[model samples]
Target: MKNSTCLLQPSLATTVALPVIYSFLFPAGSIGNILAAWIFSRQALTKRTQYIYLVNLVSANLLICSTMPFLTVYFARGYQWTYNSVPCGIVNYLGTLIMHVNMYVTIMILSSIALSQYATLKKNSDAQYSQAGNENCQRFLLKKFRQPKFAKYLCIIIWLTVLCVTVIAITRNARARTMEESPRCYNIRVEAGELGAMVLATGCFFLSFMMVLLSYYSLTRHLSEIQRNTCIEEKHLIYRTVKRNIFVIQMILTVCFLPYHIFRPIFYVMLTNNDCPRLNYLVEIKNFLTCLAAAKSSLDPVITLLLDKTFKKSLCGLFTRSTSEQHKRNPDIFIEESPDT
Candidate 1:
């Protein structure tokens, strides 16, 4: 373990860039999510099922953002955090709790959103054409998922399940650091149980990815059927809108997540072997990709703006109102001139 620690010290770039990135992400993500929370809270009483997911996503992002200062401190000091101090333990606990929770919870929630949209499309099509005549309990459950009550319950289930799983995983991986190793916050040791859990988590990601794809495919085919049967010109616009929705989620997962998950098992193997000559290089890449994954918290506000029309309208209205108030307060400084004037 001591030799592996010596060989896998974070590179200069990793130490410098990760702290800066986390510092920026901390403020940006906090402000964005706070604004989102305010906007969503105003509309909470409207019983929009979509708001359930949006609110939960914002909550998770805020939690993740709150952890960034600690993370910045960790990386800024080159992963040396007073070795087994209370703050170090707190940071490590959060790394296991909120960080991992947000990633996997975001995955499941986004997949749920895609599947919900697909359900909405199916319900609308069934209503219009009168073809879906209640196949089974699964069909009934899908229909139920469209309701706000169902969505709220589902969100609770997701949060509880993720929290329980992550807590268990962390407990299983916890160990005491020895004096032989330099007092460092991070090292290249991978427990067998943790590695297996990580592999299982990666498989969940793939399953969620396939769920989104299946939702997109189902929606496209259903829309095509509608166009063929009724020849509605608006179907083209709806198709494009759905495509954009799927594209946004897919882009987030692919850009922020795929690289980390894809590299994780390989990184684990390399770290575990201790004989890998390029371990330090891999460690740098791993840290950078982990930062990239956390970057999604800062990017999620854009997702809310793109997907929620009311969020955009509320934000625009707030800006417009502020401008009008400013103009009213400074009437003497500004004047409109007509050609006659």
Candidate 2:
């Protein structure tokens, strides 16, 4: 009886708690991402390629958030995958596809932002103080930092790469499914095929993260050089703030995803070998990690509200305007022009 009770605890915990948490998280994330999408679309006037990437990132978050309610219910019911086979297949495919899309999009955006900052810093370092007197010099500096062509090509390459990878993964997944009796749903198993999929996903994540980190490091070094040589305190302040923001965003993503990437393989190995005792504990851990990853979709909105000034103002106004009288008293807050060429 005690062993049965222990065995049931993890499943029960997920079944009971996940729905309530997701109930709140899904709506909040959906609303926030919608607002972010709207704001980015309306106010992001920057000609810089990074803004375009930022917009795409928000759009991807919105897409992910749109699917949260369905996922929330599915997971809350103890991972039974109750949806119809067709819908289940579609959802599973889309969920996996969008996750990778989000990952790559964010990495590209962060890398671009870092590169832009580095270019700006380097140019500022070389510019004569007298040359800086002309406003055109500042405009030229901004133009040098703009990389729309690179951003366009990079985005195309990323989507193409993801498309190819997804096709291969889906083909492998379908082939693996033919061997299973339960053909209606995707099941987590410790088969060689599943292991291959996991390896591919983990490798992609690690590679993207490393690229972003290297770009950030390069940008930081260039900024430091500019500060040391130019003595321009204002640019230094902007650089520090942007760096801090990037650091916070990266930290949030890393913390949310680390457990799943690190522990999932161990769980898979234990399950495949019929190691029941180890599998039990690892299953619980995997459930927790799964919840953590889903929570990122929810958290993305809050992060935007906190980090982006325009979104923050919109959110504040949304909550503060309760009555028509209050609405009349408050004027719409417009986003100030972005500092991009």
Candidate 3:
């Protein structure tokens, strides 16, 4: 409910520090996202609903990551619009646009993964697990809405929703925070009574989070019930995979998105110069925190590589290519000559 942005004097630290941070981040993010795009482009991703969403998620991240170099230079120039207005506005618009798109798409994708696991459970379980009447209704709803047949449409809808929501952040003709002194490309403002907007954004984040939480809560309760009814020695393979994916999703939110979402409004205040001089020490921390969310674009590929064996196989080939080819050419090199040579 706090004011999102309020006008104040600019700080020297943010001006200097952000460029330094982005200078390091831009190339890394660009390369990582590009590589991810290549990995996801392989024909295998289309078969799995989860990986399909991941592919889109990676594309969204790449969209944002590709823009960082421009922003690095933009911030490096102390908010000056060395570039003209239209390109700046489009870049400014896309900056917020793709970032939030990535967040929402991530939420949707994780939710689908959780629900799909539940559906899988429903398919394999017996009457004891399905005895609850309301539970039947819930499953009916999940079956109706979260069907695999509609996943592509659902992902498209999520993308459109993100664009519709963030388009409001784009200003006309000028850059994001266009002022006489600081003609910058950041979409910050000092509006009164618009605490509702910030609240809505935060609420959407937690709302998506709560949906994910509820899915896991249901999954946990169902899992516990199954564990009790089934034999102790029966390994719950699906349960383990579902649980692990859910955990990884939560970890992604915690490490990559949570800090930025938590500190965003505060950074707006800082960026707008409302508490500029007093909070100058937070400058470096703020720089790192803000970029941390975008850094997930790169980290997501790492996540894909970890969670997906297919991606791991593909990614490993890039590193082991020459050695593998060499071994293929000379089969005796890999042979163990009694370990004595």
What is the clash count for each candidate, in the order shown? 0, 0, 0
Candidate ranking under lDDT, highest first, comes to: 1, 3, 2
Candidate 3, residues 60-122: lDDT per residue as tens digits? Answer: 777767667655655555345422465555555455344555655665666666565555555
Q: All candidates' TM-scores? A: 0.84, 0.72, 0.74
Per-residue CA lDDT of candidate 1, range 166-271, in tens? 7775665455443324455555542112566678789989898888887777777777777777866754655566566876787788889899888988877776
Clashing pairs in 3: none
Candidate 2 pairs with clashing backbones: none
For model 2, the run of ten residues with the poorest summed lDDT = 1-10
Error of 2 at 291 (Å): 3.1
Stretches > 4 Å off in candidate 3: 1-13, 80-91, 94-97, 126-130, 144-146, 171-197, 232-234, 265-275, 279-287, 317-341
Tell how far residue 236 is off in model 2, in angstroms: 2.6
Q: How well does candidate 1 score on lDDT at residue 285?
A: 86
Cα error, residue 166 of model 3, in Å, equals 4.3
Local accuracy by lDDT, each model: 0.69, 0.56, 0.57
How does model 1 fare in lDDT?
0.69
Candidate 1 residues lying further than 4 Å off, grouped into runs, are: 1-7, 44-46, 130-138, 173-183, 190-193, 322-341
Across 1-341, the per-residue lDDT of candidate 2 in tens digits comes to 11121222235555666656767767887787777777566553434455565666666666666656655554554345422355555555665455544554555455455545445444444554333345576456445445576556666676687678778777765664455444223233411225666687677667656755665676577566656667867555656655666565557557876677777677655565444455455655776676676667667767666655555654566677544344335432221123443
lDDT of 1 at 5: 46
